[model samples]
Target: MAPPLVSLRVVLLYLRVLTVAFLVITVIILSTNSVTIVSQGNSMKFHFKDVYAYRYMFSAAIIGLFYAVIQLFFTISELATRTKNPFNYQLDFYGDKIISYLVATGSAAGFGVTKDLKDTFLALVVLDSTDPVDKLFSRGYASAKNKKLSKHQSP
Candidate 1:
């Protein structure tokens, strides 16, 4: 049977890589997302900055990505040296929990705002079912909103 420490180290590294990958994906999705609205021959573009929640979610993803990368570096170094540092362990424990909560709150805020805008306000106030431009705007809004929601799934 494989040693427990080897298994633990492998799992930890895998999860760290996964976290980085997800954060990168979240950043890419949120950063590139935009919505365009054409009304009465005037066109307006909306981006993540238009919504504070999305901005917050994007910031959290960026910060989390940095933290994950740093942790991954340390984890790799420790594994290669076959040495353990209690201080690093403590930092990892607290950092992981704090980042998780930060990202969770960001996701929740983004989700709530997106839900309200897409389901409640936009449906009733801004969109006209008969207008093709409005349909395009709605679809754009939905795509941006869904991408923002995906940030919550990251570690």
Candidate 2:
């Protein structure tokens, strides 16, 4: 039993390390999440700073940082205490619940932001531009519209 608990503690340590690494990456990406487009001496920028949903994601990442550190602390404290301590299970459950809800909310918010950004980018870069792919899609659309019109006009 003691050996299994030790192994579990080690595993938790590794998990915390991975969680911290991801949190750092999330912060950096959110902080620098922007792209600049220059065309014909005009420039436009798209970045997370201008989006509220992205801010929510960044906030979640910061929350995750604190959660991971606190989890690490609890893990260490559990190991330092005697094995008969029954409160560790409750602590684990509470920690997991809080982190779970936070991550779920973050995921939802991030998804909404990404979908919006994708639509905007496509409208700007694909629909309005004369790229070869756009021409192909445009031809298909015209044919579809013509077919619909012909069907409506049929005697």
**Superposition error at 24 for model 1 (Å):** 0.4
lDDT (tens digit, per residue) of candidate 1 on 1-155: 44677677777888788777777777777777676665556666777777787788788888888988998898888778877698887778788878877777766666677667666545554543335433433443443444343332212
Residue 152, candidate 1: Cα error in Å is 11
Best by lDDT: 1
RMSD of each: 4.3, 15.5
lDDT by residue for model 2 (1-155), tens: 78887777777766666666666666665676565555555666656667676677667777767877787677667667735356757766776667656755765666655556555656666333434333323332332222222111000
Q: Which residue pairs clash within candidate 1?
A: none
| Each prediction's number of clashing residue pairs | 0, 0
**TM-score, cand. 1:** 0.79
Candidate 1 stretches with Cα past 4 Å from truth are 124-155
The true-versus-predicted C-alpha distance at residue 139 of model 2, in Å, is: 32
